[model samples]
Target: MTDVPFTRTETPVLEPITMINAFTVPVEESERFLRRWKSNAEIMAGKPGFVRARLHQSLINGAELRYVNVAHWESGAQLEEAQKDPEWYANTLQMLNDPELHIQARPSIYEVVVEVEPGARLLP
Candidate 1:
């Protein structure tokens, strides 16, 4: 994906929605889980409407979820359509269905209701 300039100076269009996914995985299974997730992420990164994505790992070892993924898309429809590709779907399903890797995923979509721009507003 081309790097888009981060120079917009507007109220920030809310066209691109966000997808948040949390993953619960045991420490021992983290390697396997991450490998599968990486594969899936690479495929998704090449899809249309895929603006950007980041995966964050908890600093605390005992955090409930090991990883949280935040992805931005032009729209939910486009994101959904991107994942519907036959090959992508099959690959994703294979990872999900793997018995050895019991990864739990909680995914949700959200629209931006508020935002704090950098150095844009004075401290309250």
Candidate 2:
């Protein structure tokens, strides 16, 4: 994925929609989980209004959340539409049906309320 520049203009405030999913995967199935998650993320990236997707793994040993997915979208409606697609149900959601994986996922959506960049000063 190409890096997109995020500029904060003082006159206009922009709030990007974000989705975060925390996954707890069995140590034995961590690799498989990563692969499946990446595939799912790729599919979502192809949809309209997809801004960016990122998967983060905890470096701390024995962390409850082994993997976390943080995705940014243009709006909540766009995200809801993408989730309703049949392709998402067939490919991404189906992965959860596998009992062998023993994966637990908790997902949530949020609106970005504040942002700060280095060397950027707030206008008075």
Candidate 3:
């Protein structure tokens, strides 16, 4: 992905969509779970209504925000349909319910109403 600006046309699609933000625990457990999560792409491939999913890690002030997993879909129905899959549910539950991973976070689906793309900055 490029550090590009979101113009008018590119902004609208993101606005009406629902954004899911997932925060994981520290790397010790979070990283391990993440590795497992990514390794099983085959499971996700068969899930219904799976549009796209991406993982993110905090940089500077990250402890307050450990990891972020973003998934975008055509609609909530499609996403929900995928979740109904037994394999998807089992794999997800295993990673999430791991005793070693003491994850503390809340993920909420939001309807994006507006967006503003920031311009280049002097600081990186």
The numbered model that scores best in lDDT is 1
C-alpha positional error of residue 89 in candidate 3 after TM-score superposition, expressed in Å: 0.8
lDDT of 1 by residue, 11-102 (tens): 23337788888888777888888898889889999998899999998888788899999999997777777766777766677776778876
TM-score of each: 0.79, 0.78, 0.66
How many clashes show up per model? 0, 0, 0
Error of 1 at 40 (Å): 0.3
The TM-score, computed over Cα atoms with residue i paired to residue i, of candidate 3 is 0.66
Candidate No. with top TM-score: 1
* Ranked candidates, highest lDDT first: 1, 2, 3
For all candidates in order, the CA lDDT equals 0.76, 0.73, 0.57
Give Cα distance to truth, residue 99, candidate 3, Å: 2.2
Per residue, candidate 3 scores C-alpha lDDT tens digits across 1-124 of 1122211111223222454555657666756767766854457665655567777777744476677777666666655555556776666566656667666545555565555567735444
lDDT of 2 by residue, 23-124 (tens): 888788888888778777888989988899989989975888999889988877777777776776566555676656777777788766767899878786
